[model samples]
Target: MPHTLAYIPTPAPATPFAVGETVEVLDREHVVLSVQTIKKVTRKKVKTDCGREWMLDGEWFDGESSYPFPSIRRKA
Candidate 1:
């Protein structure tokens, strides 16, 4: 009898929002200005009514009240 090798699959990374996309952040809506990827890290530059800000994917998982991830949506 021959034994078969088991193949393991890895999950794909999540995609970041694109520029000109509308995102709801901090109870307000904003537009994604840019998406930067450095060293496998993805950061989004967003423009809101208050001002422009940078957001990272890790912020959503972290338990930091001050830094929260915003709800991203596509512009219709």
Candidate 2:
């Protein structure tokens, strides 16, 4: 079954995620990366963009820093 999400308003400049979008949570302190599937979690996590699901254990911020993924990169 598909997962349902909640609504949340994560402020702009922080909102970079979209529903059904894939993201990577960055672990700055430990230099580790965690991939996350984003879905609207709650109204608080909501933005013009969608929230996340399948979040890996790492550090992520919605409004301050860019989401990071180390293992994966855009093809050139």
Candidate 3:
């Protein structure tokens, strides 16, 4: 049987994020991590810019399918 993957949305930005980009989920402090893209965007919605705004329903290395970071501060 073929394998199937579930979908989940990360509470981060939805538009400016890129594959293989390291970002910091900003809150009280900077929490840095790396991200890898697994699928293409299916749909999108413009939401608030508070913290979790740029991410979408996708897959990551954390064994979860979605943007996990709430608010990322991209590492430079």
Candidate 4:
């Protein structure tokens, strides 16, 4: 029996929503504006060149209030 290697995938930039990195969320591309950490919880503020914002958690979980959170594509 062959053992399969365990691979831990990581998002680009090693840090989510890194400043100046282009990312795609919900099929749209935007650049990271800034990242904020409050009480150890991280949040990323991303916006488009035109000032359009696609609000999302740092983890890319866009679930509704108290709803099930699912992982989405971290980058383009």
- Which of the numbered candidates is closest to the native, going by highest TM-score? 2
Per-residue error for 28 in candidate 1, Å, reads 12
Question: Which ten-residue region of model 4 has the weakest summed lDDT?
Answer: 64-73
Model 1 off-target regions past 4 Å?
A: 1-13, 27-44, 58-66, 69-76
In model 3, the clashing pairs are 10-67, 11-52, 12-54, 12-55, 13-53, 13-54, 13-55, 14-54, 14-55, 58-66
**Residue range 6-25, candidate 3, lDDT tens digits:** 32333444545454455544
Superposed Cα deviation of residue 61, candidate 2 (Å): 6.8
- Point out where model 4 deviates above 4 Å: 1-14, 27-44, 58-73
How much does candidate 3 score in TM-score?
A: 0.29
**Ranked candidates (TM-score, high to low):** 2, 1, 3, 4
lDDT of 3 at 15: 47
- Model 3's number of clashes is 10
Q: Which lDDT values do the candidates have, in the order given?
A: 0.35, 0.35, 0.37, 0.35
Question: In model 2, what is the error at residue 24, expressed in angstroms?
Answer: 0.5
User: Candidate 4 lDDT, tens digit per residue, 1-33?
Assistant: 996644222233445454455443331223333
Where's the lowest-lDDT run of ten residues in candidate 1? 57-66
